[model samples]
Target chain A: MIVIHADMQIKPEKREAFLQTVQPLVAGSQAEEGCLRYTLTQDVANLNRFTMIEVWADQDAVDRHNASSHFTGFFKVSTDFFALPLKAEKFTAADV
Target chain B: MIVIHADMQIKPEKREAFLQTVQPLVAGSQAEEGCLRYTLTQDVANLNRFTMIEVWADQDAVDRHNASSHFTGFFKVSTDFFALPLKAEKFTAADV
Candidate 1:
């Protein structure tokens, strides 16, 4: 499985707007094939910081997700929401 | 559900030892009653960075897991493995 931890720090004034903007993307992504889980969570200690935990079946699934309209649309205007550049970490589940 | 994202930046030399230490804890935690998901993943861009994604059934479950021997044992030795302090972000799954 491919996992993505997209850490976002939103501008304080844009908090509500940011949440509103992501709701559709969250719902849209979750409904896609190979999307095992796609959740937006607020950091308990920092309300302005949010992380989207995304689990996909494979790289191809993630590619499709990236090209999806919902994703593309969000990316186009994403800069306006950021307090800092987003940090996205992609990972392959480690075998233990 | 309660979700935890425990981000760790391990000392380069301690990577192997760190993985070995976490194996038993991972297994033990997965076998616990409330562990929905417990998996360690390595960042694709950083060999020494790892994150454990944990999903629990509830707060009580999290409390139980925290007090488990496997967890405590790992915690006692965790500082030895870190190159930087661990960052743990706890979140309540957001409603969308």
Candidate 2:
């Protein structure tokens, strides 16, 4: 499986709104064929910092999800609340 | 549950050694009562960067794990391989 961790720093005041806005996309992505898990989490130390952890069957699965309309729409509107640019890390689970 | 994501930048030359060094602690941590999952993964694009994703049942579970001997032992020796200081993020899954 492939793991994607996207870190976003949202304006503190907009945290609630941002979460509400992305809830639909989270659900949509989780329902995709290759999606194993998609969860949105807030850092305990910084309520404004959020991380979305996504597990996909493969890179192809991720590509399709990214191309989906919900994702496209989320990306378009999601930038409005960011206090910092999104920082993402993708991983291929180590067998060892 | 509590989720802890630790991002570590290992010296390129020490990558393999670092992994080997921590393998025992990884196994030891996974065996703890509160540990739901403890995985060490490398970034697909950045070979020298490693992220340890740990899931614990709760704060107390996490505290106990941190206070364990394996954790203290690993911290003492593992700093030898670090290329950068550790960056850790703790998260609480949002119910919404």
Candidate 3:
């Protein structure tokens, strides 16, 4: 399995609006093939900070998800509300 | 390695308070042995929803962390702020 943690920082005033824009994208991601889990989250201490935790069957599935129209749409609107560039890390289980 | 994804819900108005109470715990957890990564996040669409993504070297590390005073303090205050039961899942890499 492949897991990804993406950290995002949103404009404070536009936090709600940013969330609204990304909701559909999140839902779409969850519906995709090989998407074991997909969730959007915000930082408890910093309301403007957000993160996405995703689990996929493999890198191929992640590649396909990224290529989909939904992701494109999500990214297109993201720049407007983002406060900082999104940061992400990928991981594989150490033991199976 | 062991990966855990925990889902939590907080009362909207008390979200900040909950985060403040947990921040120290999170920091302490990261300082523990075998802790790889730990982060707290909120749902993009739901401000009251939160999640934690954690990576540990093994289950033993998790157990030790849980037994520490930090987790106990975190849990104590968590009851007053949590909107629902915390939900968590464990996963192992498929291609390790």
Best by DockQ: 3
Give the worst 10-residue stretch by lDDT in candidate 2 chain B.
B87-96
DockQ of candidate 2 compared with the true complex: 0.04
Model 3, range A1-96, lDDT digits (tens) per residue? 788878888998888788788888898999999998888877766878877888888778999999999899889878978888988877774323
TM-score between candidate 1 and the true structure: 0.54
- Model 2 CA deviation exceeding 4 Å by range: A94-96, B1-96
Task: In candidate 2, list every pair of residues with a backbone clash.
Answer: none
Q: Could you give candidate 3's fraction of true interface contacts?
A: 0.68
Cα miss at A19, model 3 (Å)? Answer: 2.6
- lDDT order, best first, reads 3, 1, 2
List iRMS (one decimal) for every candidate: 14.7, 15.1, 4.3
Any idea how many clashes model 3 has? 6
DockQ per candidate: 0.04, 0.04, 0.47
Q: How much lDDT does candidate 1 score?
A: 0.79
Cα lDDT of model 1 by residue, A40-94, tens digit: 7665336687777887777889999999999999888778999999987566542
The TM-score values for the models, in the order shown, are 0.54, 0.53, 0.78
Candidate 3 matches the true fold with a TM-score of 0.78
Model 1 deviation from native, Cα RMSD in Å: 14.4
lDDT of 2 by residue, B19-46 (tens): 7888878889989998876767665335
**Which candidate's lDDT is highest?**
3
